[model samples]
Target: MKKVLFASTALIATAGVAAAEVNFSGYGRFGIGYVEDRSETTIVRGPGADGLNGTADDVLARSTAQTDDVILVSRFRLNIDGIAETDGGVRFEGRVRLQADEDASNGEANSAGLNGARFSVIYGGLRVDAGNVAGSFDNLANYYGNEVGLELFAGQYSGVDYNFLAYSSTGSGANAVFFQYSVGDFSFGASYDQAQATVIGAGGTTSTTVDADRWDISATYTFNNITAAVAYGQTDAGVAGVSDPSLTVLTLGGEWGDFSGTLFVADDATQVASTDGTAWGLSAAYNLGAATTLLFTYGDGNASADTQQVAIGAIYDLGGGASLRGGIGRNDCDSCASDTIVADFGAQFNF
Candidate 1:
């Protein structure tokens, strides 16, 4: 098992009779993994690979890995959360990610950067946010219930990675603006992103960044152990030749007794680098006895090539915010000619 150290500090200060609280928190995970047959076939990049019929044979030209792949999977995140209240009943909240262990092109560390930072100003039940804000569609569903031992291997299904609106270029982190409203058990949110305000083409030449804007809206309802959410969004590819891209996502999640899970689906448009259709997934987590839990996930990408993936994993609690985790999975293309085998064994902890 791996080991992790955690710490927290709280501070309260007064500025003109208005008090504020600042808290520090972070989490880290590490593990070992082995992967087979990994590629960027359907992933949406600039344009896309040629002959994208969603078939493996069609995309045989894709860059495939060299047989069995071994890797070390690890990540560390540190965030500072701050809250301040005004005498007028308004509030301000912000979060800043202080360090990223590995986010470089060559898998090196970034020296004290702010990768997942965001800030918000609030009044009544409405709030506005900016900087590294999450998109409404993705904020609602980051594959809520999926579980895997080694993210470098099986990881999340391809559907979660390419939500049309959640493209690889700007989905993870982007410069954006967002609005949110909360009332009792219901909440609503909307986001607009200018993630690529300056576009540099293949040759590092400058191009107009007007067409890179994107927007989306989402709603979530939670009552006890049951929750439901829906979101819709669109993205413009900036340069012409392809249609504008869009996505509609829905999720239903619930927990009863010792069982909990999530079901989701997505309708995608502007399938520039992926299948031109719909995708869906289901995940389940069941507690066994006192300290062990079982995890399962299944997914289907309703593309011309019929993509499907599944994973089976388990978790063993070690108390004090740590757990032993491992899983083995297989992903295959029924209509196409591609397949993958993924496995990992490791430990994770939260602080």
Candidate 2:
């Protein structure tokens, strides 16, 4: 009887240790909205796509159209993390992620399935990370569910929607590496990436070529409630006949009490044909209360034609890891016959 009790206690202790070694957490946002102008010609389809035409008055007049404005959903995510005991004391590590949207939307396609797997190894004063993940370099900021400044560097600055150009390496493709070091309230880092592009043009023209080599470096400083940073990046195409683009970006961001905002300016110094332009953007978010927030943004670009955009939105936390969001936006161009107005509302939850 004594032996059995001792064994049972040992098993319970082992189980508790195992549980304590693992960590889990996640967050997500869902949103929907109604646009007054759903006419194909009045909307900007995606980044780099041509725009549709509808009078600004006509678009704004229909703000109450009341359509299913579900813009973003399935924002749920999960994470599993743990640290391993190694020879150098104890190393710290973790992995967290979610499936890409294309993978979750279609049941028949597994080609775009897994998003990424990230791992980190830390020892002494050095840490190394390897994996498929998303990160922001420099002081350039990311606009959640909106647009990112890096897209302009890739020659994709159309004033339609939030779709911007992105570079990714997955499967048997290229990879990225990042390095960082910190002292006091200042930190600096740099990242490099290389990948291949599988381009399938219209009329059955499919081509596979080495994409581009990209590098970026940035520095940040913090003082009281303000933090500021700047970053520069360059991309060189490995294939002949493709344009090699180099980009420079400056970003300033800060937060105080209920206010947070980022201002960004970027220039594309690509010497290659069909890939040179300049762009800038500003975005701000303010907390209204514990459960509510407001967002505003403005952006412009000098590619193809001069284009500009403005947007405003709000989010309300609904408790239980859920929130309600809605926003209205407009896109205008110098030579276009019409403007676009976009509005949407939706709910997001996390578990």
Candidate 3:
């Protein structure tokens, strides 16, 4: 991520338009994070009988747990890109991002700046993007490869919980539209969006403000070294007690030498809750040659079986773009009351 060239330019506003190129990369991570016992929910207001403090009779409270802790986490991101080309051979691009963390919102680090820009158009293998697009089931290739530790953590794809349509770096977010295409090893994508959300009903008071119409589609193929993919998504909440959700994903991966793996399945459905079913996972990595590497992941957490998780990690490589990661895991769900142990250690870099 670090390419730079700015020829005839008025600094990207294309003053006289002749050339443009701008690229800068991003990455940064920091760590030492751990968690074991953690649960805290508060909304106690027991007071029926004209007891003080605004309430029509109040009564609700119960949730608490706290014991283990270890923290210090961080993040930083920045990316900016711009490119141009066109005479007959089309090309144009744009991107932007700037991020910060250490608990993004509440902690308020940098408080959301940049973001919201994504533009593209290219020809040959086809490409198109608009505003903050990035949905095609969230840009499916390898379906996230299962991620592992040092915070990559997608183990079990995190139970998915469907209601897809992604890419929101603030601003124009779901003002999406996307496209993708490739020919040889096969590739394809699709996306769409329409937004205005805020729906909540039943037991949690009530709320409404519908109009949502997400979309997604994906495809991929590659033989020999494997690689297979599929995706699907939908959202359409046309009201009527709202509930219309779907997602499907499938993946298969390969690389066999110093090993590499992937296997995934997702069926994150939703009819408004219970989180629906199907979520599977497996991830692997190995490459112990001088630069070192090793990782693993496992997940299952969609409807029953007490949920699950597993992990392992390692990485080292301090050549140029830095590295050194860490991991550890154990997770369990069903609202958890028992299993949970997480760990982290890190250092990352990228220009």
Clashes of each: 0, 10, 0
| TM value for model 3 | 0.30
- TM match of model 2 to true structure: 0.65
CA lDDT of each prediction against the hidden true structure: 0.68, 0.53, 0.75
* Better-scoring candidate (lDDT), 1 or 3: 3
Stretches of model 2 off by over 4 angstroms after superposition? 1-20, 28-31, 35-73, 85-96, 100-113, 123-126, 135-174, 196-211, 239-243, 270-275, 305-307, 332-338
Tens-place lDDT digits, model 1, residues 1-351: 122222222212444445687777877777766666533223323422333343222323444233326556667767788888888888888887765443312233445556555778999889888877766865675445566664533323445434423312212366678888989999998999864545544433333555667899999999898888998887777666767678777888898999988887877665554566787888888999789988888877767554677889888999999988889888776456767777877887888
Higher-ranked by lDDT: 2 or 3: 3
Q: TM-scores across all candidates? A: 0.75, 0.65, 0.30
For candidate 2, the 10 contiguous residues with the lowest summed lDDT are 148-157
Per lDDT, what order, best first? 3, 1, 2
| Residue-by-residue lDDT tens digits, candidate 2, 107-171 | 11223233455567665544555554333342234422233111111112332221112323233
- Alpha-carbon shift of residue 175 in model 1 (angstroms): 1.5
Please write out the lDDT profile of model 3 over residues 169-249, one tens digit for every residue. Answer: 545576678899999999899888877777655443445777777888899999989889898888887788656788889
Judged by TM-score, which candidate is best?
1
Q: Which residue window of length 10 is worst by lDDT in model 3?
A: 1-10
Q: lDDT of model 1 at residue 29?
A: 71
lDDT of 2: 0.53
